[model samples]
Target chain A: DQQVKQNSPSLSVQEGRISILNCDYTNSMFDYFLWYKKYPAEGPTFLISISSIKDKNEDGRFTVFLNKSAKHLSLHIVPSQPGDSAVYFCAAIEGGATNKLIFGTGTLLAVQP
Target chain B: DTAVSQTPKYLVTQMGNDKSIKCEQNLGHDTMYWYKQDSKKFLKIMFSYNNKELIINETVPNRFSPKSPDKAHLNLHINSLELGDSAVYFCASSQEPGYTDTQYFGPGTRLTVL
Candidate 1:
């Protein structure tokens, strides 16, 4: 079963605009949400994260908003740049000692010039 | 210096063969993990070792085994490789085992089984 889901397979946004990537999870046990950006032939790099206690977390141009009631989270990039174009994976940390990560299928975001 | 590194960026092997992928981290982190990314780009955790001790072992196949000789090294050994086993394997390291710690990932090793 896919505990985390990214409905959109791809997204396109122009540079200097905003880019939003959405993710949803069915597991209520997940208390931490994270976003990772990946390039082709490379591993994923951490972007932003949010805890269940907080509704939003921001780091520079990247911001992550979490809604526990909706079981959803989103990553927003302000004034998206070409460098922001990459595959974004939304992951949630399962509540337990293991603290394992469950990832979504990922969304390919393209920032147009 | 590279934070995390994996040897043999690409590997092609025939079915029924055994192969090992080596991983090392220089960040002095206590936790290391192996993640498998399939064709669908779904990254799943395979195994994790913290301070040279096995911590998380997911529902991976029996043919796949993970060994951590120390806190900075984690290796994945696959026996009797199958076509379905082909995927990009990534090694990651974190200061701790939980989600609060940011994990750093290696470039990844792409394994192809024929």
Candidate 2:
């Protein structure tokens, strides 16, 4: 079973615009959420993260919003740039001793120039 | 210097063969993990080691084993490799045990089994 899911396989946005990537999870035990950006032929790098207690967290141009009630979270990038184009994976952290990271299928975001 | 590194970026082997992938981290982290990205592009956790001790062992087969000589090194050994075992393996490290909020990853090792 897929505990976390990214419904959109791909997304397209123009430079200087906003890019939004969405993720959903069915497991209520997840306490923290994170987003990772991956380039081709490379390992994923950490982007932004949010705690279950907070509704939003921002780092520079990246912002993550979490809604526990909806069991969803989103990553928003302001003034998207072509360099921001990459595969984004949304992950949920199952706290406690398990401390597992449940990842979504990932969304390929293409930023147009 | 690279924070996390893996040796033999690519490996090709025949079925029933045994192979080992080596991973090391210079960040002085106490936790290390192995993740496998399958053909369907699903990244799943196989095992986690903290301070040279096995912390989490997922539903992986006994043929697969993870060994950590120290907190900075974790190795994965696969026996009787199967075609389904072909996948890109990644090694990651974090400062806090059981806390993966911010983990660094190494360039993956792609394994192909014939």
lDDT of 1 by residue, A1-113 (tens): 99999999999999999999999999998998899999988889999888899999999999999989999999999989999999999999966777588899999999999
Against the hidden reference, what TM-scores do the models get?
Answer: 0.98, 0.98
* DockQ for the candidates, in order: 0.77, 0.65
Pairs that collide in candidate 2 are none
Tens digit of per-residue lDDT, candidate 1, span B24-92: 999999999999999888899999999989898998999999999889899999999999999999999
Write down the TM-score of model 2's second chain: 0.97
TM-score of 1: 0.98
Candidate 2 residue-pair clash tally: 0
Single out the weakest 10-residue window by summed lDDT for candidate 1 chain B: B95-104
Per-candidate local distance difference test = 0.93, 0.92
Return the top candidate by DockQ.
1
Write down the worst ten-residue block by lDDT for model 1 chain A.
A93-102
The CAPRI category of model 2 is medium
